[model samples]
Target: MLILHRRVQLLQMTLVDCTREKFSKYEQLLNDAGQKPEFWDVVVITARDDSQKSIFDYQISLKKQRHEVPSFVKYIVISDPPGVKVGSGGSTLHCLEYLANNFGQHSLSQWKVLIIHAGGFSQRFPSQSVLGKVFLTLPCSKYPIQMLEALLMMYISIPGKMNYGVFIAASDVIFLFNEKGNWDFRVPGFVAIAHPASLKLAKNHGVFILEDMISPWGKYRSDPSSPAMVATPKCFLHKQTAEVLKHKDSYLPTVPI
Candidate 1:
């Protein structure tokens, strides 16, 4: 088992008030720890053309901090070809495919993939952002398509132990914490429901499971505050789950996701 000192981090919700100062501090926090690349890795992507020079510089500063950031904790950026509508979800899918194909699933040790959009900032974008949410909202997505796809992929990918923390950030910047006395990014429940609980169910069909764990045939919906999202099998997914992901264009897009 792998373990590291957990940092209390902050999760950004919007681009508004997105001054360099606000997040710049977090970079220092990650760097002070002298993070080795093998300790953590992140794959961040952009759907539209945005000035990521700032974000890049921010990460580079942190990555270079031998005292805090690990020389081994490598980060990369990917782009979808122009004209191809690779939204948030698609971007994430594409990143995963690219990572798996080039580096193989085992490339990064304990990896984390953040599928954020250039235009879209975060969940708080529409409500609090200075500009409109540029994230491509899928026709079917009351939520954003990229966001849904990201969550879906994360839902499936996380069951197994990952190299980098495998995640799909629809349009949010990742920050390493110093000691804010807040959220712990190490725990999976921040985004996923715990597995092997009693509510576990096995059903059938190409069902769009409404709960945390996928049910075969049933469609479930839940209250925002309720917990029993879905029942999950203990341990990780077997090779069978990987076979399921290989179908159609399940992997990340070479051009986009």
Candidate 2:
């Protein structure tokens, strides 16, 4: 377990170094546009009912350290009702309802929400089962930081990319991207980040088949600062076999949002 954790930290550090320049530029762009780069009005973390106390304890720890958490961001933990087995999708809906009830309908349209689904037991990683996966300690930095803090840092630049809307993500995955290109986040509906992956890896994940066979990274070579491509998915295949993926020309596996 220690070796696995160290490997994760090394990977995370390498990716952060690779993307540092681009992320800095992106944040500067946001600042130039008169926006607070990493500010999320509300961050809602979903947890199992039994994990509520520990999650709150984590929040309190953050408060004790004055500089740990952002002042503009509000953290809310919505625990699943006891004995209720609401899955991720259901928990998301409950979170939305909770927001509407507490913050009121009018305020909903004004605030940018980041909903993190961290409710499940970490069966595969039994070491984290007690504290929940999101609260798992990370060894990337000198100051102690948990998986939740690292996840927030990974997505810090995203709030400035779009208008008022919810950014939903799972607790386990960390996406690293070079933000050199412009991303059109003002699209009408839902937008997701898709990462290139091998067919073997895509087999157990959601795969996006594009309408055209055009390369999304084609412009990156010619113009590294070109706007990133966003396309309406031609089709979506969930947990499909490699044979099925081959037929669909699947190359990019979407990061589960």
Candidate 3:
């Protein structure tokens, strides 16, 4: 699920305006200096407790080779201390504490944050085990770009309007959408993007049960100018069996085979 915070109270600026100003300043700097400035205020990459050094080494290699690694952006690697295996959630908490202690809460509150959870050794794709999955080269890209670069490109437009709130994302999956399309991020509370998938596919991922079974795709296709349809989720089930989904009253058929 993709969740976006509406605003940050400390900044006292609308997310959209804050985001725009950030990009505007970056663009001006890039044009003047002929090099990219720090695009993100703080980029925290969570790593496994033992793999912290390896991740740091990988970044150094990328910079030495002059790849697409954005060295300009301030990146901090946070891992579980000592014997504790805090997992993703714990690592994030450790990051917050580190920031508060080092940068102070007041200063940290004003900065835009991007947290990437990419700590696991890619056992399924063992070739990426050393460098991790985030550095895996994509075959579909026109030019050579690693998974990290591709993820950054996908979110390049989102930060401009965002306030001091954090943007958290996983490194494994990529969501494709129209870059120029109108996307509303001003909605209050957590906003998750949903995509249509077959029942078999849904079993392996999270499925949202909406209030109604009516399909909104018909209206969306018929009138492109209309506002995007929003649904009220009644419940969300993760990795549920096909039989369980079929029995749910609000469960609607997904994409057909």
TM-scores, all models, native as reference: 0.36, 0.78, 0.71
- Per-residue CA lDDT of candidate 1, range 85-159, in tens? 666657666767878788887753435654445544345655524222322233432333332222222232232
Off by over 4 Å in 3: 1-39, 57-61, 64-67, 81-84, 107-109, 212-217, 220-230, 254-257
**Clash pairs, model 2 backbone:** none
For residues 65-146, what per-residue lDDT tens digits would candidate 3 score against the true structure?
6635554567776666667577766777787788889889875558877777777767798887767777778874446667
Candidate no. 3 TM-score: 0.71
Clashes of each: 31, 0, 4
Q: How many clashes in candidate 3?
A: 4
| Tens digit per residue, CA lDDT, model 2, 26-118 | 335334545455468998888888456466557646643645555456788888767768898888888999999998987667888999888
* Residue 161 local lDDT, model 3: 45
| Best candidate according to lDDT | 2
Q: Which residue window of length 10 is worst by lDDT in model 1?
A: 1-10
Query: How many steric clashes does model 2 contain?
Result: 0
lDDT score at residue 132, model 2, on the 0-100 scale? 77
